[model samples]
Target: MKTLLNVLLRLIETARILGLNYRDLKNAEDLLMHNEFGLCFDTIITQMYEYEIEIDDELYESISKIGDIMNLKPESYTFMKELIRDESNIPKPLKDELTRIITSLIE
Candidate 1:
């Protein structure tokens, strides 16, 4: 379950990197479903750290909409915190980038 979640999260990160809309997760899913799923979530998370993508208010609104469709509570900080905790091994750069992204969305 963790692995799957991490894969999905990495997909989200990748989508962000490519300037893909988070609200359009179908595109992300389609892009990732074909890729090999063998990599460790830590590795993917680390890559996310290496890449910095800005998350603005528009992105947050889009994420909230996507979360709603996916039955995820975007308003909850707990899930975000848990993601950060579980991905603690991520590189400082990617972690900082993601932190800024998620933080902006939360606010």
Candidate 2:
């Protein structure tokens, strides 16, 4: 239940970042039935590529804790490492923010 709640929160946050309103999730069940679960993280990565935004500490900690508890596979870990390290076009402040977040995860 806790995991589900976290995933749902991430889904809602993703929609919000995509400039979506509540109505966008009105048909969520059907909509999500056809989408990849990993797309949520991919969306975050893509958004980071375009522009950085604050990720609340709680949310970041939730993600990091989940990853740590799960002992995520090497491939998944590599994927995350790649996503966070992709600072190609981000502004300095956002880049620094990402660096901090990634660094936290590293430790």
Candidate 3:
């Protein structure tokens, strides 16, 4: 089972991939430092969606695992749906992953 630490590590990985410094996610970092795991997770997830950073297959899988550790916000579905619908832009595997997440959310 994925843990909160795994989620935090994934978030840091995402920040690096996005070329964002760890300090840039100050709110999430502070929340995490304060042991506010849920809030920190939510903040990082929201920031990622809002940033619309490019996601590869590996990162998508990592995010899926992180999502399993915490209930994803409804916004995640909307954002993922947008990605899945953009067939020209998203890879098949990534779309499949998003579909899996959406199906799980509804179940």
Candidate 4:
């Protein structure tokens, strides 16, 4: 499995491909390096949503897998659930992963 930092870097690369400004994530690398997992994850997801970046299933699955390691907070869970619900274009696999996370939270 890819480490969280590697995932974040991949997101940055995606942002570059989309021509979106990725300064927030670039700055947040320090947080991840310092072991600030929650903030790093939150920032990546928040920026992705704000920029309206479309995540493919493979990348989304990687993010989902790392969520537990990040120790996501309550609001992070809510944010993810909302992301899954609101993004109509989300790929099925990505949606399924998000659904799994939200369902796990509910249980």
Candidate 5:
């Protein structure tokens, strides 16, 4: 998931643009630990969609290039297609439940 690192770096820019809280930092770590590039990319995309923000094309391109160089499996691409067909609906696993879970744990 080397490409995921590229995506994460770009996500920092996205966070700045959106002025999000520090939770994004924790989310980034969780994504890395999980090694779930597709799932987490979908989550990021879905969150941007919900917030009516534009996706960063350059970051996306960087991720795609890395995936190609590393010959990543088709899993992420396949999921992306499904998200497109479903009109960017956030899948169940990518829901915001973690934020609540983490919040509760911290509290």
Candidate 6:
């Protein structure tokens, strides 16, 4: 389960880094279920933050407004903090990308 979740998380993050939008996420979700990831709709919000990818205000608002329709939940901000603290579990490519993204954001 953990490995599956990790892979889903990694794919979503990779898609985001490649500039995929929510629609892309939807497509990815279709593919994700086929894998052993065991991801539920509720997990997407948490996964978004886990990747340190930010959604704009309008997108965030939209996510909040229609989350139920999409079967997602409002993820707790603390999820990000916890995810960020667990670097040892992340893949090297993802870790490198995240570091690049964070560095660019800071600069």
Give all candidates' CA lDDT scores. 0.45, 0.48, 0.63, 0.63, 0.53, 0.51
Worst 10 residues of 1 by lDDT: 77-86
Colliding pairs, model 6: none
Each candidate's TM vs. the true structure? Answer: 0.30, 0.37, 0.56, 0.54, 0.42, 0.33
* Clash pairs detected, candidate 3: none
Candidate 2 shows a clash count of 0
What residue pairs clash in candidate 2, if any at all? none
* Cand. 2 Cα-lDDT: 0.48
- What digit string (tens of lDDT, one per residue) describes model 1 on residues 57-99? 4434544444454454444311222223223366455778899
Candidate 6 to native Cα RMSD, angstroms: 11.7
Instruction: For candidate 6, write residues 1-107 as lDDT tens digits.
Output: 45445545665665466455676577557756665232433345455654455444444443444343334444533343332334337654577989999999999
Task: Give the CA lDDT, 0 to 100, for residue 78 in model 3.
Answer: 41
Candidate 5 lDDT, 15-84, residue by residue in tens: 5475444565457557756876554555554454444443344545654554565466655533333323
Least well predicted 10-residue stretch by lDDT in candidate 5: 77-86
Cα-based lDDT at residue 71, candidate 3: 74
Model 1 Cα displacement at 71 (Å)?
A: 1.0
Off by over 4 Å in 6: 1-28, 31-40, 68-107
User: Which ten residues in a row are the worst by lDDT in model 4?
Assistant: 77-86
TM-score of 6: 0.33
TM accuracy, model 1: 0.30
lDDT at position 61, candidate 2: 51
Candidate 4, residue 86: Cα displacement in angstroms equals: 13
**Superior candidate under lDDT, 1 versus 4:** 4
